[model samples]
Target: MNVKGKTILITGGASGIGLEAAKQFLEIGAKVIITGRNQAKLDVVKKSFPSITAIQSDAGKEEDAQSLFNKVNDLGGIDILYHNAGVGVPPLNLGVPNNNHLKGAIYEMEVNYFGVIRLNNLFMDMLKSRDEAAIIHTTSILSIVPSAIEATYSSSKTALAFYVQSLRKHLQIINSKLKIFELLPPLVDTDMVADRDDKKISPAQLISGLIIGLENDKYTIRIGDSKVIYLLNRLLPKVALNLINPNKYNEKLIN
Candidate 1:
């Protein structure tokens, strides 16, 4: 997958991992377009990177997804559709049933799982038409081993991980040229996890690993502890679980 000279569209590109990916991709000569829900953030990104295109769109909304597809198609479809947009609801105790629990779970599923499917469906035909096209899905290490504190977030990522595998196989069976890539990142140091005290990797480190994966055609790119956890979960499931949920998370849950 030669990313140089390719056009890439990244969702949730205003900040965090997505923003770092945009910067790295641009450095490698890829034309980058970023979409985000916040107009102010998108405006700031555009000002900072005049060459990068920034579009204001919510990944979780059906109408916004459709509008984004139409706009991207008009601008000439992308060779790579990077699904970096994801959301995690604040941790809540599932043992105590509450209305907010269901609402939060639904929101997480919509943005983290269903939104990836929605955008992929819209861009499938366009991607297929390209000579060398790929879809990158940002799944999480929690998908390999669920987190007790972040149960819904883990479930959403797990669902997406399954979908990415199935979608890749389906594309292969159909003899399609389009490629599906899954990126599993562990405890990234981003605004989304600011309150967490867990060991974290910088967004730059994650994106650098991702770019290397893209260049080498590594369909499943696991970064940092994600690679460690994936192997540990297979060989030592209990140890993997203990590592992910430590004592602090369990204490919080009990209290």
Candidate 2:
């Protein structure tokens, strides 16, 4: 879809991919409203990009979603609802178990899965009312191939991916023009994975792929190496699984 002359609402837009996208969207002439849980971060982003609107909202909470809805209403409705708010896995290495780790995993589920659902439900009517609209969910490649160290994080995305697919199918049957797009980005070079030494694509690359995918009417946009990973998982499940969680094959190598 042409991003120009559109009103886009991006959750978790204060930093990382969301922040970068907000900047690009603003440059492309879209009225961008970004929501985050931290007011200070939002304020910082506002100071940096005065054109974009930044509001503090926690996607994991119903009240926050409602408040965001009201805030969007004030901006005259949104043409694009971009679900980017999510939590990364805890820093604990694999094989290390703790009660706090379990809690963190559960929290990831609430934010990564249920939070997106809540916001979607709250914004469905507003989107359906618009002449041209789209819903983009930024899932992960881990959904296709679970990360051993981030089991809950991967699982949450897997569940969300299924929901998005089902929602798309329903929309198709009803002949609704509301577009649904899922973005699978693998190890992006953002704050989420800044400390990692693994190779990662820049946010600019991700956004470029996204725009091209949308323009070509692609339903699922796999950025960078995610496309290869998705194919590997589909054609060679065991191989893909082993590749993602190399530790799973460690015992065999040692043997």
Candidate 3:
């Protein structure tokens, strides 16, 4: 779990949180390989951190993930699979109609949900092939509760959280040396949440907490408002579920 000398792969690793995490991993002396949909952005990141291996790949594609596995195999092996790629869709104008919802759902599912599935399935084999490894998913606080505004994004993250937990149980059954962790970050000031008028944690702080959690072998890590999720889940289940319900009754939308 030590960051030093470990090789880590982070999907969607070009900008925002992914980029921030990549930068931190480089500082921690880990060999960092980052993937993203945009080659141009990866180029810019390379200019800043030449040590990182930036691969231009769409994590939404299973074939791309398989190719990623090939890349990892060529590297000898990987110590950590940081599933950091994601997207936020369902543009504000359409207001969650069926078509817009479907579009958003596809984008979100492709990147956030199924993308994780393919990445995990492919990298997990490589991880188990090694002596020890770690698998981490970057989800959102919305995964536990509906945040109202990001309908499609929220739903996909919610599904991702469930998937991570399920993966953990399966790993226990197989008795794999690979450890699984989930990061439920609060609202962040990234392109994904640039329009939202909400408080956000800086990317560096989030990365700092994330590194500490992973290195310490913490099973699941939550930062900022996501900590509220753990507290609410433990102390107030009904209120937690109600908070996740989108508050349609109090709001004028569905009421």
The TM-scores of all predictions, comma-separated, are 0.99, 0.93, 0.89
lDDT of 2 by residue, 1-255 (tens): 887899999999999889988988888788999999999999999999888888899988889888889988987889999998899765554465568777877788889989988988988888988888999998899988988667778888999999999999998999888999999998888887777666789988888788788778798999877988888988999999887777644553233
Q: Write the per-residue lDDT of candidate 1 for residues 157-228, one digit (tens) a residue.
A: 999999999999999999999999999999999999998899999999999999999999999999999999
Can you write out model 3's per-residue Cα lDDT over 21-115, one digit (the tens) per residue?
99888888999999998999999999988888988889888788888788778977688999888888634433535566677789889998998
- How high is the lDDT of residue 248 in model 2? 45
Colliding pairs, model 1: none
Least lDDT summed over 10 consecutive residues: which range in candidate 2?
246-255
Q: 129 in model 1: Cα distance from truth in Å?
A: 0.5
Model 1: how far residue 121 lies from native, Å: 0.5
Candidate with better lDDT, 1 vs 2? 1
RMSD of each candidate? Answer: 0.7, 2.8, 2.9
Given candidate 1, what's the lDDT at residue 104?
A: 92
Of candidate 1, the 10-residue stretch with the lowest lDDT total is 246-255
Error of model 1, residue 7, in angstroms: 0.5
Top-TM-score candidate index: 1
